[model samples]
Target: MIEHKPLRLLRHLAWIPAIWIAWELLHYEQYKLLGNPGSVFLFTVLTDWLGFHGYEKAMRLGVGAMEIAASILVLIPRTQGFGGLFAMGVMSGAIFFHTVSPLGIDPYSDGGVLFKEACLTWAAGLLVAVLRRDQLVALFNRIAGRDAAVPA
Candidate 1:
């Protein structure tokens, strides 16, 4: 297992660049494969969800900074847990927005995009959860130890 650690790290690290590239591609409209309407809807949803409705300029800078920080933390072994937590928070907000806005799946309509986003968010959260499992286990163990030491 130890021998494969490097490969595993590489795979995880690759997601960062891939995500960045995809973001850039979308931002520049270099790839319209997803359709303009869908892209516009997604951007509007993101901006609104992020509380940048009337603050587009600030959000433009803030979002990039936040994303870079999150990506950097995620790639750093010592800070991966923190990064994962941040990612989970952002993704959860996204999922909530989609679910609450009537933008999600519909049996008779083309609402599958929301479903796809939700699934992706879950997958990302799961990745972080798995990455931080050891820390979680250790925290629980510490709490259990403290309880065991109590006189009651």
Candidate 2:
């Protein structure tokens, strides 16, 4: 049985996006968890806009926890797709909030760095998820009580 060379190369290259997603998530952990002024300001503005008011701490901690989980999953070869999906979900919320809320694209006046990173991270997560779609399909099959080995 001959394997397609492009597919083989893609399989190897999949790690690049996986690592990027993981690194981005893990890198932001300190800001979210440790109450960095920038993170605090962002979350405060977001919570205020959402009418969550004083729940900024909870939101920040919750997001930080999820990021930690996603990063760990992304670092594992077998669970990379799940992690990517997790990242996409989280980043989707971030992108939405950034665009719709008063936060705007350049909340910190840092030239929209945060917004751009979120977009790039979302794309990276998507790439990783697509690359590991086989695992996603198998997982879905298992959840749906179908045989993963059988074609749908």
Among these predictions, the greatest lDDT belongs to 2
Prediction-by-prediction clash tally = 0, 0
Q: Report clash pairs, candidate 2.
A: none
TM-score each candidate.
0.48, 0.92
RMSD of 1: 8.8
Q: Per-residue CA lDDT of candidate 2, range 1-152, in tens? A: 57678866766677898888888989999899999998999999989988999999999999999988988887787787888899998899889998999999898788998889989989988988898787788989988998774211
Q: For this target, which candidate reaches the highest TM-score against the unseen true structure?
A: 2
Give Cα distance to truth, residue 139, candidate 2, Å: 0.8
lDDT of 1 by residue, 40-77 (tens): 55555557766668554454445445555665555555
Worst 10 residues of 2 by lDDT: 143-152
lDDT for model 1, on a 0 to 1 scale? 0.51
